[model samples]
Target: METSLRYTSNSRSLKIHAKEKLLVNSRTRLQLHGELDTGTGAPSYFCAMIRYFNPEALTILGLGLHYNKREKLRCLVRGKMEFPVRTGVPVTFNVKGRCDFDQEFNQRNPKGAAEFAWSVMNFQEDQSVRLKVGYEIFEKVPYMQIRENNWTLNANMKGRWNLRYDL
Candidate 1:
């Protein structure tokens, strides 16, 4: 089966595509490939965590930073894993990012700005997933600094799957 999922965080967003080739050896595994995009303007950071279901237990994998020019900070992650059951499966992941822009106007009085983002995902029993993301920004001068600005996002995702057989 082949499926695709997407997520948007505070400073980053990702799309995950997966394909299930066969059910054999009493096990089923999916191959996953995904791309992540970082927000524009200023320096942005990206990070993510992936979880898989296995007979032994739930396994977690972490991904580092990936960048692309045309996409303006694009990242790719790929892997394979097996699921315990074919019934409704649950998965969870998290992504985070930070951006900072600071320039020195003088020796003591410098301009500084920073932005931070965090996201979470939860897959339920109905083949639907819930997502949440939050962002915050702060700007400062040598003597004074502005209050931090914060924002949040909430979303639900539905995935489509296709199955293939080989003998």
Candidate 2:
């Protein structure tokens, strides 16, 4: 299979100046090695470590169909991710998000201290595939709290894969 992947990020208060394409191989392993442009400073660096859950556990929970039937399929992914400021200055808050795909798939808050949820879906078509991701960040501060006002960030990624099937 020949596959092409694309990624996009749209932020509300923060702006995604640039995004580097992720590289993956036939083994379904993802490797990240790139930089994203920032505003008025040096570009930010990206690094992540992801762990996938078992497919059988996911199927038992009715998350989705296990069509591939692979023993070690990826069900849930927990990422210990980091993104540094462009100017090498340490911000007051550290940003990190965790993507979980259990019975319910969701994305955690990026601030690493806030509580939030995010979800992404990958759909396959005849000759192409599309990935839609929605993220929400809810922050609660002392003296005042931002309750239900969820900040929305959406991304649409599309790609076409070339498959080599030996019948």
lDDT of each: 0.29, 0.27
Assess candidate 1 and give its TM-score to the true structure. Answer: 0.22
Report the lDDT tens digits of candidate 2 across residue range 136-158: 24333311111112222232222
Candidate 1 at residue 119, lDDT? 20
CA lDDT, candidate 2, residue 125? 32
Count residue pairs with overlapping backbones in model 2: 8
Which consecutive 10 residues in model 1 have the weakest lDDT in total?
A: 140-149
Clashing pairs in 2: 1-162, 1-163, 1-164, 2-161, 2-162, 2-163, 3-161, 107-118
- Candidate 2 residue 14 C-alpha distance from true site, Å: 12
TM-score of every candidate relative to the true structure: 0.22, 0.25
Q: Model 2: residues >4 Å from true position, as ranges?
A: 1-30, 38-41, 59-167
Residue 105, candidate 1: how far off, in angstroms?
40
